[model samples]
Target: MELVSLIIMVLGLAALVGIYVISRVSRQHSPQKRDENIPVLRDADGNELSSVCDDVAARDGKRPSANARDMSDVMMSNVSGKSKGVHQPIADAVALPPQLVLFIAADIEAGFSGEEVLRALDNAGLSFGDMDIFHRFVLSAQGETSLFSVANGVKPWTLVPEELVMQTTPGLSMILNLPSQIDDGDAINDFLLTAERLTADLNGILKDHNQQPITPALRAGLLAMAA
Candidate 1:
């Protein structure tokens, strides 16, 4: 009876060891667990943006190739034209309130030349105006309605053409005041379109209020604000 008990104990120990070995092997062959908290970027249509290599490069603090950056420009270009049909007039004497702002930053290490930004602004139809910044205006039966404004990304936020002739800035800031006299949807769309155009022309990066690169999720949130 004692011998039988010993044999049974040995068999149980061997079974336990085998189970442990199997678990170790399975774990070694299993895929690594992904971090669930990482934000998944998607466009308006739920299409994913950026590639694994781009993510990896971003994580490593390496600048992505021009092709990768151009992809974002293409995406912006496709949606930038939607604001053309929104032509509601805004009150000329409306008071300015707190504003929602977006940034177009130069991706190059040396930043953007003032001349380049000036030309881009001209092409986008933003004229230097009140407060030393650039303003976009829409003509209507009432008169000219300001759609949005652009300022220098640097401090003072003004674009004095004389100073700009010799100045080099990191980028430009686009500002839109909410709850204004203009149609919110139209204003936002026009603002985005202008920003997109400037970004493409300058080969810059479009950033959110926080100055981080604009993600698809962020883009959706911006569009939703008009709703």
Candidate 2:
């Protein structure tokens, strides 16, 4: 009986020791608890998690990634050339913001002298608005066109004497200056109409910088902008 009791006590002690070992091993292999201080980063749609490696690099003050830097440089280059291309606005043809110049020229072989030219200007129903001793003349709008005025003190448009015409070209050229800084679109268009009429009266041709004829279609388009 004593031997049987001794064996039972040893078996119970062995069972308790086995249970302790299993518990300790299971605890050692179990997953650790999540840390609450770490944030869970997600993409824009929350469909997937974003890489936290970038955050780590940023925190360390490292330069941006090579792909990011390359994209930035490309965007900046495009912005730098935005105003330098042929993609200018259509409105610029009629109303140049800074300044606009129109050259009206007539051939001198029309059997008319400079005195006749001055007389035609007087007979063209044009009122003299301003004049400069430097042979600059500002013609006034004869009718409703006179209603428009520029905000600045700048004289709208004037015909200035051309020394070049006096020396060459077998004709006379007049410069119409419309610096918008001193004149408005209405004034500019009104002056252009006067120039065209006077050129026709003097039997002169209106030519542009490239000597191209000023077509009626182009003049109509610019005049239409006033309405």
Best prediction by TM-score: 1
Model 2, 75-94: lDDT tens digits are 23333334345234334432
Model 1, span 1-227: residue lDDT tens:
99999999999999999999999999876544432112333445555432221212332243323213233343343334234433232223122223555778877655778999999999998888777878898775578865667877765667889999887777777766454447766777777778889999999988855467889855754554443
RMSD in angstroms between candidate 2 and the native structure over all alpha carbons: 35.8
The residue-level lDDT of candidate 1 at 5 comes to 100
Model 1 poorest 10 in a row by lDDT:
50-59
The positional error of residue 208 in candidate 2, measured at the CA in angstroms, is 2.2
TM-score of each: 0.54, 0.36
